[model samples]
Target chain A: MSTEELQAWLRRFAELVHEHKDELTALDSAIGDADHGANLDRGMTAVLAALEEAPPADAAALLKKTGATLVSKVGGASGPLYGTLFLRMAGADTFPAALRAGYEGVLARGKAEPGDKTMVDALGPACDALDAGRSVAEAAQAAAEGRDATVPLVARKGRASYLGERSAGHADPGATSTALLLQAAAETLS
Target chain B: MTVGIVVVSHSRALADAAVELARQMLPGRELVVEVAAGTEDGGLGTDAMAVSAAIEAADGGEGTVVLMDLGSAVLSAETALEFLPDDVRERTTLSAAPLVEGLVGAVVVAAGGATREQVAAEAGRGLAPKEAQLR
Candidate 1:
C-alpha cells in the first residue's frame, strides 16, 4: 500500500472508533470500567489533530507519532497497549512485520497471550493471518472471528481477570477494538 | 537533596489521600512528592502526560522514584519515563512497590536524605512488614 493509503487507514480507523464508541463502551461496561469508548475516542481525536498540526513525513513517522499521542492522551491499560502497537510497527520494513512487531509489543506491555481475552486475542489471530501471506481482508475477517471467539473464554489478564469465570460470555472490549482497527485497515488499504 | 517520590494511581482521590497520609506520617520533612492519577474527566484511569509532569514536579535533583497503584498506573509511569530527558530518565525508577505503604516508606527514606536507590529499595520493601506480621 502507498504511504497515503496508510495515512488514510489511520483516518479511517479513527472514524471507525468514533462510530463504534458506544458499542465498545457497552462491551467494556460488562467487564471493565465502561470508559474504553470514551478513552479511545479522545485519544484518536488527539491523534488526528496532531497529524493535521504537524504532518508526519512518512508512514513510519505517522505511526510513531500516533503511538506517542495515544500514550499521552489515552489513560489506562488500553493507552499503553495500543500505543505500543503503533510504536513497534513504526520500525518495521513491511506491513506483516509491522503487525507482528505491534503484537509483540502488546504482549511485552500487557503480558497477555492468545485466549487471554484481551486485545491480544484479536490482534494475535489477525497477525497470524497476515504472516501466512493472507490478504488484509482475510486478516480482518480472522480478527473479527477472534473477537467473537473471546465471548466464551475467561479473561486471564487486565481488570477483567478480576471477574474470573464471570468474565466469560462477555466480549472483550479491547479485542473488539482491535478487530475494528484491522477491519478499517483492510477496507481502507485494500 | 533527598530523593523525591511520585504516586501514580487510577483515582485522583486515591493518590491525593496517599500523598496526604505520607505527608502526615513524615511531618516536618518537606519532601517533594507529587501525584498523577485519574483521567482528565476524573474517571478511574491514569495518563502518561500527567505522570510525566508529576515526575518533573517531584524531582528535586536527587532523582524521583515513582510508585504505581496498579496495572495501567505502572504502564503510564513507564511511558512517562520515556518522555523524560536522558539524564532525568536515567535517574528515575518505577517501583513495583504497593502504593500506599510504598509511598509512606519512600517518604520516610527520602526525608532522611536517602539516595534514589535507597528510597526505592525501602518503598519496594514496604510490604515486607505486613507480610512478616501476618507470619
Candidate 2:
C-alpha cells in the first residue's frame, strides 16, 4: 500500500470505530473490560492528530507512526497487539503480504488462534481470502463472516476467557473491530 | 548491583498505593523503583510507551524486574522491552507474580541488593505465605 492509501485506510477505520463505538463497547461489556471501544477510539483519534502533525513520507513510515501512536495512546491490550500488527506491516512487499505479516504479529503478540474468539477470528480469514487472490471487498466480506462466526465461540483467550462458558453468546468485540478494519481496507486500500 | 522494580498496573492509584505498601517493607535503604501505570490522562489502562519510560527510569545500571498487575499490563511490559537498549533488555526480567503481594516481596529482596533473578524469585514467592496459611 502507498502512503496515501495507508492514510486513507486508517482514517476510514477511525471513522468506522467512531460510528460503532457504543456497539463495540457493548459487546466488550458482555465479556471484556468494556474499554475496547473507548481505548481504540482514543488511540485512533491520536493517530489522526499525529498523522496530521507529521505526514509520513512512505507507507512504511506511515505504518510505523500509526503503530507507535497506538502503542503510546491506546493504553489497553489492543494497543500493543494492534500496534504490533501495523509495525510488522511496514516492510512487506504487497498489501496481502503486509496483512498476513500483521496477522502473524497479532498472533505472536496476542497469542490467540482462530477459535480463541479474538481479532484473529476475523483477520485470519480475511488474510486467507486475500492470499487466495480474492478481491479486497471479498476479503472484507470474509472478515464480516468471521466476525459473525464469533457469536457462538467460547473465548479461550483474553479477558473474555475469564467468563469461560458465559462468553459464548456475544460476538467477540475484537473480531467485530477487525471486520471494520478489513472493511476500511477494502474502501481505501483496494 | 541492586535490582530495580517497576510496577505496571491498570490504575495509577492502585500502583501508587501498592508501591506505598511495598516500600514500607524497606525503611531506610534505597529501593530503586518506578510506576508505569494507567493512561496519560489517568484512566484505567496500561501504556507500553509509558512502560518503556518506566523501565528506563527504574534501571540503575544493574537490572530491572517488571511486575505487572495482569493482562495488558504484562503485554505492555513485554512490548516495552522491545524499545530498550540491548544491554538493558537482556538484564530485564518480567516477573509473573501477583501484583500487590509480589511487589511487597520484590521490594524487600531488591532493597537487600539481590540479583535480578533473586528479586524475581522473591516476587514469585509472594503467594507462598497465603498458600501455606490456607493449606
The iRMS of the candidates, in order, is 1.3, 0.7
TM-score of chain A by itself in each prediction: 0.97, 0.98
TM-score of chain B, candidates 1 onward in order? 0.96, 0.97
Record all residue pairs in model 1 with backbone atoms less than 3 Å apart, i.e. clashing.
none
Q: Residue-wise lDDT of candidate 2 within B22-79, one digit each (tens)? A: 9888888888889999998979999998998898988988889999998899888888
Quote the lDDT for A21 in model 2.
96
DockQ of model 1, rounded to 2 decimals = 0.69
DockQ scores of all models, one per candidate: 0.69, 0.80
Alpha-carbon runs more than 4 Å astray in model 1 = B129-135
Q: If scored against the real structure, what TM-score would every candidate get?
A: 0.94, 0.98
Location of the lowest summed lDDT over 10 successive residues in candidate 1 chain A: A1-10
